[model samples]
Target: MHKQRLVIAGSGSTYTMGMMMSLIEEKENFPLKEVVFYDIDEQRQERNAKATEILFKERYPELESFSYTTNKEIAFKDADFVFVQIRTGGLPMREKDEQISLKHGVVGQETCGPGGMAYGLRSIKDMIELVNDIRTYAPHAWILNYTNPAAIVAVALKQEFPDDHRLLNICDMPIAIMISYAKMLNIDVWEIVPEYFGLNHFGWFTKIYDKSGNDHTERLKSRIIDEGFTPEDTEIANDVSWQKTFEQARQMLMDFPEYLPNTYLQYYLYPDQMVEKEDPERTRARQVIEGRQNRVHSLCDGIIEKGTAKDADLHVDIHGVFMVKAAASLAYNLNERFIVITENNGIISNLPEDAMVEVPALLTANGPKPFAIGEIPTFYKGLIEGQYAYEKLVTEAYFENSYQKLVQALTLNRTVISPDKAKAILEDMMEANASYWPELN
Candidate 1:
């Protein structure tokens, strides 16, 4: 059993401690020889480092090593796996992304519409830099990127690092959905297998079957149509915003009625409704800043004040666990099936070969081997094509620094259809993200 060296690139993120907790729980399966936390912010990372140190000492004092650093070389050096979850401009810029879009009367979400495009533009440069650093220091390290705007990020990475099979773009939303389905079916999540396809946030569950080959798609759809996506015991269901997003699946089912929709589709399928529902002053970023951000910081402060995390109630985030599990699968050659974002390459017969699509894949020590999802219906094909065009153009814009391409990308978004609105939103985003995004002319 080879003990691995794990590096968390965005160690200051609110989710880092939860990932550490997950590593603690799965120590026996995925032994860690060393764990390094890397973040650019000194103050914030130190708080996380303090809490993690306390937890590691109290929980697993004999663990080989645990440390945090701002040095990219120190963090990535000799690392076996790099967990990348970076936010380029953090919450402040995210809030700007949302508010700017809302001012223009479009849906302003972190990972959808104009807001997502803005985020994508800022993220590409950072993501590329991280990848380059990882390759330089730890060429063999597996990079499991859980970054937002995953669809766009994946597309850009594919273009940038076409030959790097070690890089895997993943999102926990599908796993979160499966957890809900498991709760509804009264079975452990591991007992079920799902067949799904689409770009990141805009995918659907075509089939779900148990180990015994019992198809549960219709049964799940029936429940979703009647009562909405009510997962009895899950972290995502606890939040009011998330609850609304989940429940909106019922309406999507009413309209599409062919497959179970991802919660994020609410942004695209009901862009007008989403805009109407949003409060410009108090966007989702504000809620997270007030809720998860504050809570995590407070918990860290408490751990630091008490000098122990023995009694501190920390959330065991399933999202973090999912990423850790994927890493473990790769390390141990478990060949577990997971939904990840990868290039189509004929995986979806109807979509362009170059487009990145999310589909179920078998994870092994090698990399993801995506399962084939044959040609989709006309309606889904059209929707995906439009979104893929926007994603491709955004990636191109970032690399080419073409303001025209950026405008074209925003214009294709479901949330901002008009060229004038797209231009206004792009210019506002450019001004707000001046420090982060590259000069586009």
Candidate 2:
């Protein structure tokens, strides 16, 4: 077999960088011939690049490693697979994302709301560059993107470059949430059979079963209701589930009859709109960025600060073991249904076929095979349609300059921000993320 090439975008992110570092602990890494770190900023990638090289040399000497410039041809040359976890902008802009949302009174966070849409805009250009690079240098390479606003990014990519087949978009939320569930049931996440669907941070828990055909969701829900969360559960949430699930669960249980929803938005941001007059920290994003973010990013930073380049080889999957198994299942999964993003194609009864909806699907080497969604409750239809509109608008904004599209994204977000406040926050984000998102300006 030929050697495998993995190109990891967003090498600067501590989690992405840490995941690379953890690769050393992997079992000989599946015949990796080379690994490439691609980032727009040299300063950002250098730390991770040097750290990884040191780790690889010390722990996995046989594995080859190289860091690439953002140059498309040079970076993507002959890649076999691409692992992309781009933020487009760095943490500082993320702070602005949350702050802006709070001014409008919507819960503010990195990848939800007008702020998330803002983050989405800043990222599209860089993502487009990566997409274009694949077309140029590694057309056959499979691109597994774990970028925020996964739905938005995926929609933009599929719309702009309709011909690309090597694209697979994913969010770590579902996998991470499953891990949270697995611990409650005293099993590894991979051992659990689950059915779930929704857009990235905005999805649902449809079904869950264990090796013995046990529906564990009710069990998991009861445990969490009683116990709140465990060490492992909190670890995954603080580190990588984004801020969506945990924060949302408490209210979901209180506000509706639905299963306590996932954490995609629970702990994210709770304000409706952002305003300069309010205490900056009062905004959910600011509270997170100023107060909670370091708690999260520091996990990876600690590993980097403590380790030499040689230590990079030992980076372990501290909170992401679930993904390893999910990835594995694509090749040999026992036909389990997963909530994956796929074209509706009438797979979701009553939903538009051309639209991408999250629904139960079979995972195989052939790709995600979505099953029928059957009839949804009327309430769900309206909610889903609203979210669908947001995704479409964001995707449209990327493809063309339509203020109308941006409006739709905000209206559906419905985090309790007034339309006027939403527009204000949107404008602030457009200005703050100006460098990262040229099209919006």
Candidate 3:
């Protein structure tokens, strides 16, 4: 058995740390030849590294063992897999992305708003470095990119590394959506055969069946068509009410006919749609502001201040399951069905040949070969080219220091109002994130 050399790029992130701890406890899941944690922020990652060391010492002492490092060459060399979960601008930048987009009358969610576009600018650079690291060290390694603005990042990678199936971008929203679909159909998600496609969060359910040939969409559609229309129900978050994804899927069933839309598509489809100032339903932003922010900050502060795990507690972490599982399947050649982002390569016949597409793919020794998604909606067809232009152009600009191209990428974001506003947002964000994107010339 080939021992896997796994390197997690953003090892300092709370989520990444949680995942490392998780792997330590679930010794059976992470059978790595070596686990390497890589991050540039030594002051921050060292703490998580210490905690990881302590836990492994106390628990999974028999495992192959782990090492944390700031040197990409040392850490990533000979790696089998590298999991990336970086926030290019960190917390301050996230807030700035939201505040700036809101100022321009756009919905300002972090991962879905102008903030996402802003973050994408920085991300394309990081992706480039990760690609370079692979070139320098683990040429055979597969990168599982779980970073923000997944759609944008995937687009950049597909164009840049056209033949490098070694790079796989993934998101868990589809997994959750599949599970929800299973609940609606009274079957396990594993048992349901779902044929789905879209850009990232914005695609939809097209075909549904069981391996045994049971059609499940009919049952799902009948319940949501308001067949027994409720009069007193306006609450979107009610238990009987659907998730944001289900609501969007319900809406898409009207015109598309073949598919139901995903929530990520909301950004592209409904640029002017009014989200409530105070959403009664759960929003990741509010969750961040109210809970995640405080908790993550306190966690960081505790480590920085204490220099020990005296106050640290083991949180049941699952993120490692996502990263390692993908790599394990690839290593073992299981060809598991995964929602991965890869170059279209004729998968979606309508999109550009280089466009990054998120669809069901099977991993093999060679890499991902996506199933065909015949054609997307006209509106999505309209969307694909314009978005791809920015994704490609931005990557080019960052690589070549093309300021004009960077501006073009911002203008194409769709959320940017005009070229003038584009300049303002770009300049302001670049200034605000000088530490992150200092290459602007």
For every candidate in turn, the CA RMSD to the true structure comes to 1.1, 4.0, 5.2
lDDT of 3 by residue, 1-441 (tens): 566677888887767656766566544644666778888888667767776666565566665768898987888888877888877767566777676666656656666645776787778888787788767887888888889788878877766777776778888666556655666666766576667766665566777788799787767666656542221211122323235445655555654555545646666566666344423234445456556545655765575566554567546433455456566668778787677777777888888887777787777767776788887778777776776776677667766777788778767867564788777767767776677763767
**Residue 242, model 2, lDDT:** 38
Total clashes in model 1, counting residue pairs 3 or more apart in sequence or in different chains: 0
**Candidate 3 lDDT score at position 24:** 60
Model 3 segments more than 4 A misplaced: 21-30, 57-59, 224-258, 274-290, 296-320, 396-424, 438-441
Residues 182-211 of candidate 2: C-alpha lDDT, one tens digit per residue: 877889766777766555666667767887
Candidate ranking under TM-score, highest first, comes to: 1, 2, 3
RMSD of 2: 4.0
- The model with the greater TM-score, 1 or 2, is 1
| TM-score of candidate 1 against the unseen true structure | 0.98
Q: Whose lDDT is higher: candidate 1's or candidate 2's?
A: 1
What's the CA error at residue 305 for candidate 3, in Å? 12
* Candidate 1 CA-lDDT value: 0.90
Error of 2 at 38 (Å): 1.0
What clash count goes with each model? Answer: 0, 35, 2
lDDT (Cα, tens digit) per residue for candidate 1, span 250-341: 88988998988888999999999999999989999999999889988999999999998988987666777788888999999999889999
